[model samples]
Every structure is written in structure tokens, then in C-alpha cells.
Target: MIDRAIKLWFFSALVWLVIGPAIGAFQSLQFIAPDWMNFLSAIALPYSKLRIVHTNTVILGWIVMTFISAALFMVPRLCNTPLRFPQLAYAAGWIWNAALVLDLVLIWAAIPDSFWLSIQAGEYAEAPLLVDVMIVAAVVCVIASLHLTVFARERPHLYVSVWYLLGGLYTTAITYLVGNFLVLAFSGEGYQVIEAWWLHNAVGMIITPLGLGTAYYIVPLAAQQPLYSHRLSIVGFWTLMAFYPGTGLHHFLQMPVPIWINEFAVISSVLLGIPVLAVVTNFLATPRGNWSRAFDSYPLRFAALGTLYYLATCLQGPFQATAAVNWYVHFTEWVQAHAHLALAGAFTCYGMAAGYYMFPRITGRQLYSRGLASVTFWCMVIFFPIFYIGFTWSGVATGASINLMGNTIYQTINITWIPRLSRTITGTVVVVGFIAYVWLLLRSLRVGAPYESGMNEVPEMGIETPFEEARA
Candidate 1:
């Protein structure tokens, strides 16, 4: 029964995964050729609005849903108990998904006379206040279900993964409230400050911990290894909770908030290195003797590559957060590239690894084809670096032209256009990888190998997991 709810949440994430990236590809086209949007004048979405939808759909719709699914999967296993009210969990997932669909309808259809009527003012907070309330209600229900599940736990001790997942959900509710509601309630400088806090906390508080929590569980389970250090995991968790809130103001350094806020943000952003290092060390260290197995296991591959991307993101984050570096690179294409390295490169892989790792366990079927999984992995592994490098290259050129060479934003176009074009083409290939992932997931339900009595393992997993041994 709990598995049924997990499946619903997972599939919901998959649906949005395909939709978000597909829209993102088209949004990239608006950069190369703004006039191309004229064809969609029926929808009447400008590039800015199109961009908002793309970002929110990916962050809110896809990644956030994936995190919820992760929690649903993790909480039960960690607690050693079935979900307390599986129907409520299932229904909450459906309601939240419906809210997301309504958001898409409201944004794309343009039924409302004013933009604010369709959505809200903030970037990721653009989902209308109504949608936010609906989602908050849905999440509260899910949280209640999850808490009841935890409270009924047979396990005597909680694992670090449980700590992170449940903690993340609570933080998500509060941060979502602050980002969507409190940010809207105030005006003037107060509004700007809270908006800035919400912007960074939306990712740092909500998505980061959830993504990390999922990775912590999936990586060790898929690799069949103990976490590098339980103490380090707790260290990462607490340091993250402490340091992340102050990190938001770093992004809005140019705003005239306060000199002290700038100093606090930079300091905290640098302090963020503590958790980042602890996490990267733990993730990377666990697969020490098993690197060779990664090539054969698609889940392992996703986990491995995801960790590498995490390391890159953490290293880059602290460096770029410095006041000196933030000046020229603030909103440059480099920032865009950096953001994708975390969300697309790292957390997306974590979500994929979780989905692939758990798909068989939940459904009692093997993957349809390791061959297709390879295609999906390699497509992402091949094209994403091309996309990232091309993007960062353009950003560097753009930054130099404007900050160093005294060129206008328009003046940098000739220098940056080629790389931007490369970004579009390569990014589409990466999107193709995600499409293949969704296709393989859909195909597995019909044609994937099914388990029967006395089967040694799920045919897809070459490793012997505890679940497999239990099945045996």
C-alpha cells in the first residue's frame, strides 16, 4: 500500500521532469532568436515569463516532487514500518500534483487580465498565492502522514538519512511560507531583504538538504557500503542548518540593504564550505574500492557522477560567493552555469539514481533494459559538460567584456553568441537523455522482467543487496 503511494509520487516527478526540461529547451531558443517566440503568440508568453515557468517547473515541480518521493521512500525503510496512512500520502501527492498542473494552466493560459493574477511577484515564488496555499495544505497532510509513520516506528534508532529527509520537510514548510507569504506581506527594503533570503533559502534550505538526504541513502545502498562516517553526516546536517540562512544575501550584494548584511552573507557563504566539504568527503569516500563496478551499474554510475558534480558545485560555490568574485560574476552566464552544475548535474542525478535504484524494489520488476539506461547515462555524461563548459565560456567572455573591458551588455553579444549557441545545442542533447530516462521508466512497467519465487535478485541489479537477499 505504501509502495503504491511512492509510485504515484515518483511518476508525478517524472511527468514534470519531462515537461520542465522540454520547456527549458524552448526557452533557450528565445535567447538565440527572440522573434521565434512570435510563433507562440497565441500563448503570448514573453521570454521573461517563459523563463519563470521554466525555472519554477524544474525547481518546484520536478525537483521538489522528486525530493518528496525520496522522503516517502526513505521514511518507511528507515522507520521499519509501513506508512501510517498510505491513502492520505497517496491523496496528498495527487493534490500537490494537481496544484502544480493548475499553476501551469494559470501561467500558460493567461486567462487573468493582470500578470499578478496569474502568478506572484518573486522568481520561484511566482506560483500564485492560491497555489501556494493549496500546496502548503497538501504538504502539511503529507507531513502528518509521514510523522505518523515515524511515530509508529519499530526501529529503535533513526538513521542520518531519516534525520535529513524529515528535517528538510519541516524546513521546507517554514521556508516556503516565508518565501511566498512573508515576502509578499512587507514592502520597501524589508521586502527586498526577505525576498533575497527566500531566494537562496528556497534552494539552500529546501532543495539542498532533500537532495543531499536522498543521495546519502541511495549512494550507500546502491554501492552496498557503509556511510563513510555517521558523525560527518550529522556534522554536515547541523552546519548546513546554521550557515545556509545567512548565505542568501550574497546573491543580492548590489542591493543597498546594509554593509553588515553583506559581510554576514559573505561570511556565512564561506562558512558553508564546512558542510560542503564534509558532504563531498563522505560521498566520495564511500565508493573507494568499488569504482570499477560503476561502469556496469547504471545506478552506481549516476551516483558516482552526481558526487563529482557535487564536489565541483561546492568548491565553486564558496569561491564565487566571496565579495571580490561576486562583483563581476554576480549575474553573469557563469552564475547560470554554476546553478545548473548543482541542480541539473548533481541533484538531478541523485533523483535518477534514487528512481532507478528503487524502481525494482517498489514494483517487483527489473529494469526493461540496461542498454537504454546506458544510453541515458552516457547522453547526459557526454553532453552536459559540453553544455556547462560552453555556458561558462560565454559567461567569462560576457563578464570580461562588461566589467573588465567597459563594453555594454549589447556589446558583448558578438563575443558570447557562439558559446550561447553551443549551450543551446548541447543542452538539447542533455534533455534528450532525460527523455530517454522517462521512456525507459514507462517501458519498464510493461516489458521489464518480473520477479518470481526463488529469484536470486532483480535481474537489473548486478550487486547483491539486503533487499535481494531478503527476497531470496
Candidate 2:
């Protein structure tokens, strides 16, 4: 049976996946029709709080929790030992949920006026203390889980992937706590700087490390090959951990942060390309002659796309960080588009790969169908471009409107109705993708088979590797 901790973690992911996006959709619609649901809007509370909750849920509730569970399962297997204190692991899951619940309540209640303003500096003292406490609770829980795994068994040496997984969580815990509470202590303009830095920490230390760890585990396993360059992988991992934390300074380019911060952000961002290339080389080099084989597997396909998007997004990120380029795109839908593409498209794609890899093992069933998985992947391919291009086109139009038309943002937006209209229409395709995902997951859980059924060969890369020969 799948460990109870794993079950709870998956359950958290499923719940937040639905709730977070649903709220985001509501927020998106609020722009199209302001008063259509005035009562409901009021009930949801300030927009900033709602947005924060949604963002936090997606990041903490879904992504972090999912990894926490996956790592718990993987560690024992990698260490070649039975889980130590499995019951404690399950208890930690409950503690995590309770902490998150408190966080949600504090987030909603902290911001009194516009959700937007509360996130600002006016009510610094009144802001949520739960945010601070939640950080502590989260770190403690993580330490417990890791301790259980690390001490459970003795290996001659820890794998590189295991090192990354643990290092990512440990650093993320420290950074998350420091960025939110300690930095936000100063009230005035420092608040913006602190917040921007926090945003950087959230993406850099949290999401980026998690993604890296997942890729390290997934890529070599799928290719049935050891990593191409262990040295390069180690260099890339260390450089990224050092460099990514500063990337947040780019967000303050147009704002009134120190000018040097912007310059440093640009330089570090350019240096990021090195690590990006390193990882890309490692992943792509895996299936050299067997390219078709990896593509044939839907999980690998998603992972491939994720790596591709990661390169694209980082390239865009560095370019956009430049003062000349940002002057045109800052605060425009263009920035939003890139962010969504990177955060949702890139990360979600990788996460899907992990999920597909995990599903059958967790459920003790075979995938329902490969054809359905392929269909879902192709739909993603189509949906991604529509959103990407649509947002880029609209951003250009919006920039022109702001620069040349002498018209305000709201008025200029009306002139370029096609872009907004297309965006909403394209958004429907993403909804379809989510629906397909739900169907695929449910069917796999209920009707799938074991790896030894002549369908999938369970690779020896460790317990986390997905079986090949079935659906993704």
C-alpha cells in the first residue's frame, strides 16, 4: 500500500489544484465583469488577500506538499531501508494541513482595505503573524521528514539527486522564513524592496530547487542512463542556488529600489544561461539514439517540453531584465504572459511528468490508455502557444497605447479588444486540458495494472522512476 503520508500529500495536491485555480479563474473574470457578482466578490474579501491565498495555495499547498510526500516515499527507497517512523510522517502531514489552514485564515483577515493595499506598507504591524509562525511550523515538519529518511538507513554515499532534494528543502526553509518576516520588518519604501526580494526567494529558493531536484531524478531514470556529466550537474546545481536568489532584483527595475540591484540582477540573470545549458545538455543527452522512445512516452514528452520552456523563459527573463526592454514591457500583460508561461506552463508540465510517473505505483494500477495521454499532451502543445502569443500581442498593443495614444490603460485596452477577447477564448483550452487530466488520473487509478504485467519495465534507477511500456 502507498504510505499514509503519501496519500495525505496527494490529497492536499488534489484539493489545492482545484481550489487555487478556481479562485484564479474567478479573479480573471472579475476584470471582465466587475459588478456581475458583487456579493460574491465582497464575500471573497480583498483582492490582494484572495490573490495571495491562491498563489500560496498553488505554491505551498500543491507544489511543496506534493514534493514533501514524494520525497518521503523516495528517500526510504533510495536508502534501501523501510521507512523509519512512518506514522510520524503521517502525523506531520496533519500538522502541515493545520498550519496551512491557520495561514489561510490569517491571510484573509490581515488585509483590511483593498487586498492590494494590505500587501503594501500602511498596516505593517497589523499584518498576519501567522505568516511568521507558519514558516517555523513548515520548517520543523520538513526537518522531521528528512531526519526520518536520512537516518533510516546507511549507504556508502548519497546520490547527487538525494543531496539536491535535501539541500533544496533545507535552504528553502531558511530563506522563506527570512524573506517574509525579517525583511518585511522595515515599513516604508524598504517594504517594496523586501517584498520583491521575497518574491525572488519564493521562486528561486523554493520552486527552482524543487524543479531541479525533480528533473535530476526523472531525466536519467527515463533515459535508462546515468547522468551525462556529474561534475557539470554539481556545478549547475550550486551556481543556481547561489545565483537564483538575486534574480528577484530584476522585478524592481522600474521601481525605486537601489540602482545597483537592477544591474546585479541583469548580470546574474545572464550568468543563469550557463546552468540552463548544463541541465539541458544533461537531460537531452539521455536519449541520444533512443529519441523516439522517450517521445513515445507521454511523461517524458511533458518533461521535455518543460525543459524547453525553462530555457525559453530564462532567456526571456534575462532579456526583459534589461532597462531598455523592461521600459516597454513592465506592468504590461506581456510580463504576466511570460510569468504564466514559465510558472504554470513550465513547472506544471514537469509536475505532470512526475505525477504520471507516480500514478500507477501509488494506485497499484496500470494506466487506462496511452492514446488519451497523448491527446492531452498535444492539447497542451496547442494551448500553450495560443496563450503565449496572445499575451505577447496584447502586451505590444498595450505598450503602444500607453506610449503613443496619450490614453490611459483602461481606455487603450478597449481599443485592442481582439487581444483580450482572444486571451479569454484561448483560456478555455486550458480548462479542457485540466478536464482531460482529471479523467486520465481517475481512470489510471481505478483500472491500471502493475509494472510486471509485460506492459512496463520498472527501471533500476531507484523507486521514484516511472515504469515504461504503459501509458505515460
Q: Which candidate comes out best when scored by TM-score?
A: 1
Q: How do the residues 1-472 of candidate 2 rate in per-residue lDDT, one tens digit apiece?
A: 2367777876677667666655665566545555664556578665666676767677777677766666665666656676666666677677777766766776765556553323434221223455446545755665666666677666544555666677778877777666656765677677777777777667677777677667666666666665666667777888887787778778778887778888888888788887788778777776676677676566678878888888788888888888888888877888878877776677777777777766666667767888878766876688767867777888888888897676797797686667766666666666567557757777676676665433323223323323221223
- Measured over all alpha carbons after superposition, the RMSD of each candidate to the real structure, in angstroms, is 4.1, 5.2
Q: Considering only N, C-alpha and C atoms within 3 Å, which residue pairs clash in candidate 2?
A: 48-115, 365-448, 365-449, 366-448, 366-449
lDDT of 2 at 146: 69
Cα distance off (Å), candidate 2, residue 240: 0.3
Per-model CA lDDT versus the true structure: 0.82, 0.68
Instruction: Supply the global lDDT for candidate 2.
Output: 0.68
Q: Each model's TM-score?
A: 0.93, 0.87
Local error of candidate 1 at residue 224 (angstroms): 1.4
**Per-residue lDDT of model 1, residues 317-397, tens digit only:** 778888788888877899889889988898899889888877877777788888889988987788999999988998889
Instruction: Determine which window of 10 residues in candidate 2 has minimal summed lDDT.
Output: 462-471
User: Model 1 — TM-score against the truth?
Assistant: 0.93
